[model samples]
Target chain A: MIRGLRKWAVPFAALLVLAGCGYDDTTVPKPEAVVTTPAVPTTPVKCDNKLQSYAPSDNRGAAIANLANKGRLVVGVSGDTLRLGSRNPETGKIEGFDIAFAQRVADELGVPMVVRVISAADRIGLLEKGEIDMVARNMTVNCDRWSKVAFSAVYYNATQKVLVRADAEKDYKGPQSLSGKRVCAPTSSTSVDNIKAIQPDVVAVLALKHTGCLVKFQNGDVDAITGDDTVLAGLAAQDPYAVVPKQGKLTDEPYGIAVNKGDVALARFINSVLDEMRSDGSWKDTYDEWLKPYLLVDATPPTPVYGR
Target chain B: MSQTATPQAAPPPAAAATAPAPAPAVAAKPTPGLVDTPALLNRWQLIGMTTAILFGVFSALIQFGGWQADGRAADDTEQLVRVQEIQSSLLRADALATNAFLVGGLEEPEQRKEYDDALESVLRQIANAAEAQPADREVLATLNVDVTAYATAVAQARDNNRQGFPIGAEYLSGASTELRADALPILDALVKANTDRAENAMAGQHPFWLLVLGIVALVALVWLNRELAQHFKRRINKGLAIAAAIVLVVTVVTAFAALLRDNSNDSLREGELATAVSEANARTAANDAKANESLRLINRGSGEGFEDLWSVSAKEVEKFASRDTRSGWDAYVAQHNEIVELDRAGKWDEAVEIATKEAGGSTESLDAFDQLSQQIVTANGTQATDDLRSGRVVALVLSGLTLLLGVAAAVAVSRGIGERRREFA
Candidate 1:
């Protein structure tokens, strides 16, 4: 029996010795592709704009005309916004309220709409960098954006306002009540700058995305999300959150397509399209199609004021 | 056994041949007789010698058995210790996953902050421990991926909460749910794998004492038997008796070593394994319960979403029940069922209240889980500690003892063989 056991032991030992640790080599999934569309040229390409001379202070006006003739419309846009220049999870497409407007101008220009996605702070610099021809990313016309870039017709009228949790709606009225509370808005937009200018004591957190600003409100990270009514309305669609500073517009957030200072003709072309869009009901159609989903059905059309 | 051992029986033929002449050789020369007893003996002599040989064979067998047991026990203990630390972290992870689900679901200020703090801590602990551990790359990688998901969930949760969007809860709940579901099963698998090690540790303690005792017993018996022959004034056959005695003792110790090892394994299987599996199951259930509550909120009785979140969280709770469980989570299940029914009926307020009660009760906390989870955690912890108990001093001392005992057995066997060799010459 001992001899028999000894014979078996060696094989058992060998088998145990050969026993190896388990292993599995799983293939790692590659990172998802981000479709990087080419940036539009910001140099003044509006050859038609060269026919007319504009004031030297029109830094943005001169640049748009130089950039537009290159057959590319460098329209400054936002990439972080959903339903407007935001990523579409299904088709991997970027679409929204503002993009269509930019597309229409580019389409009318007979140029490729190379949308230069940007934060508001860089809108002016991008035009200066000759990296974009126009800014249509819901930019508010104030002394600030106007000082850097010449404006065109205001297509959309925006207002600075407050968004709060539905529960808090009963108490909060305006800037004074919002004191000691945090407010958020995308940096370089009129809402944040205006909040600073108006409710200077209000703590403001500047986020890159308006959605982010709105989320801060939801997380109770802030008391209010302060931005253009258009942006805030977009935020409200995703959540049941309410907008405050209840009635009437704050500082008039006049939506304009920013152009280089000297580019009168491209501005004229843009102006004519706005005119055509307004007269031909394209402007109303765009609003009815895009912004209508998030706004009141009785949303009144803002009168388009022409640039000098 | 026959299939493999048939060829091995070849050596016994030679032993039979050598067996005949030992008695004659013992008579011819006293000096040669000492070394040459068994080799010079025939079949009858060998057969007669076998009875006396039992002690020696048993002693050697006992010594070997003890040595094997000692080695296995040492390895088992070391592994269990390591497993325990990992298991504890995993346990905590399961709890935090539930917390994340709960907080993300509520998107309430207190809950969100709590979830964030707990999850961040879990991630940090996992990272810190991972650096110190010698875990498989795949396991480590998976853990890292889980951490990233956790981080993303936290970020997104924060974002959505700020916006007052319920989707933040949905995202966080999703992260916690998927992770808990996938993660616990893997951890349970890890715990199950070390069962053999736990048994080996328990069995290891006995072999050294058994070996030493066998050596002592065999020596005493051989000395007593040899002197008995010498007292009679005859060259008595005592070596075979000693050898035979050794064989029996060795066989007993070997069998005992194996038995004790099996006993330890049984202990681990019954104790730690059961605990790990049960606790993991409970944790997953808790997570599912929380997730279901969150989904109920996210769905908000909207469109097809009500059906979707319902299916997801329902499956999770059920999966926990199917796995091994320690405590009867019947209380939790009862609450969950009511919540689900209320949810199905679109009674949001009632479901929310029950959810709050179920989630908030300190007694039903995931840390304890009604004693079952605690017991399971303890069992797994105990099993896991075998390989992982820390302190270099204890390890050094244990290792030294094992080595000394092994060396002592080997030397004693070698000496016995040398003494028999002289008679064979």
Candidate 2:
């Protein structure tokens, strides 16, 4: 028996070696860092009155002809900004303060309204490209945008402000309180530059939209979020922990409806609609319904300025 | 002649006494030193036996190594397919989740269940992969953490969406971004590592080495036969001849078997294995494209970025799609192009309608392509692994038989040399 075992030793040893075969531990490759281009600063164009627009006219025929799509009024608006222009989950319709204005313009033109959701950065580019007839998203009139796109008269006077965690609300006095803290704002918005100008030391982060900033604030990625008071109000209503404390405005963000630079007739038509909303007292009523509870202030529509 | 007398002869003593007065002419040719014939025969027998036995051991070992390599190749192929399945499943889950979000807060129940099922498959497969391959355990562990984080974020997004919060979109977007950044690279590494291991293991058949070993053994046996024949006055030693014959037969047979196995492995690596890997890639790309479609709608008018991403993923699908899946992919592409046209024409509602509809939509075509590609991957992957494993048992048995044959040849050598010794005595 011993001899027989000895005779089978080589095969048995080979089997043992085969059984013990193993590989080196596998390794995971490190993820490559995502590269993003920093926003470039351009020379600001100078203009006397950025809030100026073509004088109001009831030339609905010319404005309808200027529509990119013949039968429908394609208006770009925000789908994520809650009180201004956002989708309602139950109704599956985008209805808010800004959307109401767009709907009125479409109604007055005797056309169907097509709401196109867009980001803050694409507001001017989409207008210039003739993709939308007008942008009723809470876009501000500024000298830089005035060179690229035409705006209707200022309809709402908004002010930029900062929102902080509710626990940090007591210490927040103004932009100075956010010094040396991370603050998030929508990319391409004037609010980031406004906050940075005031404190000069606040680290400004950017998101695709205001709600995106709220997400960052909730995730503790940023200590505060800065945007228009109305936009901040919408963001604050979503999170109980977030609060926009009583603070002075960083800048007067005069809201306007942006149209293509060459679409002066459409600009005139939008102003006409805004004028009607103001005369009919519907503008104040819409404000009371949407912005009153959260803003805690009675407001009136900004007087439309024209003569461009 | 008297000095050269055999030691076994009785006359050697008398001859030793009488032959001393012999003539010394030409310095009397020196008598060849006495050879211990038995010792020489014993030495030749030992050399011959050892050569045959060693040939058996080494050749059998080579064959055994080949057999083991096939088994390992099968295992590696299985692991490769498993990692790829995890990749596809994760993307499939993302596609379902993103598509469901297009319907607002109240998502379709079936769609939600599909998303859940896909995610569950990913988690379960990760665990299975870790258990199957010890080498991949660490990466799979990290992957598990990333997947859990993604799931948590999606859950938050869903809860918020149900309550009509716009921040829910942000949550979903962040989750998708994190999944691609954190989880995908690990999966890529696993795919690469297993691909290399499987290919390397498949190439393990060494027909050249087997041939070389056989030739060297044959040469040694032939030389031993020559040495024995020089003394025994025969051109061939029967025992050595038999051993050489055994060596030749075993070399031809085992070498041929190894060559056949090598060719089979090559075929499998290029055919079924390639199909499985490429089809799996196509499936993953298809799912990625579908997710980008939903994301474009989610982002609404500013979704040009997502549209560009969709184009890229669609191109990837086109590049990797097999003939079997091309028709389904083509149908999906046509539908996708129609949606893009409608979106560009500012008919977003119409585009969303076509995109979100249940039947005759881009979703249905893409689903068909995904399912077909998945089936192809499973079938071809199983075939490749099975082919590698099927005849391994026969290979093992052949290896053992070669060893026994070697020993038999060694015994034949001993007996044949023993006959020469007996004749001399």
TM-score of chain B of each: 0.55, 0.90
Provide the lDDT at B345 for model 2: 74
**Which residue pairs in candidate 2 collide?**
none
**Model 1 stretches astray by more than 4 angstroms:** A1-308, B1-135, B163-170, B177-236, B302-328, B357-372, B383-425
Q: What TM-score would every model get versus the actual structure?
A: 0.42, 0.90
Docking class of 1: incorrect
CA lDDT, every model vs. true structure: 0.52, 0.87
After superposition, candidate 2 runs with Cα above 4 Å error:
A1-21, A31-40, A68-70, B1-47, B414-425
Q: How good is chain A of candidate 2, measured by TM-score?
A: 0.95
Can you write out model 1's per-residue Cα lDDT over B341-414, one digit (the tens) per residue? 76445354455465554445322443344245445555565554552232324333433343333334333333
The per-residue C-alpha lDDT of model 2 at residue B222 equals: 88
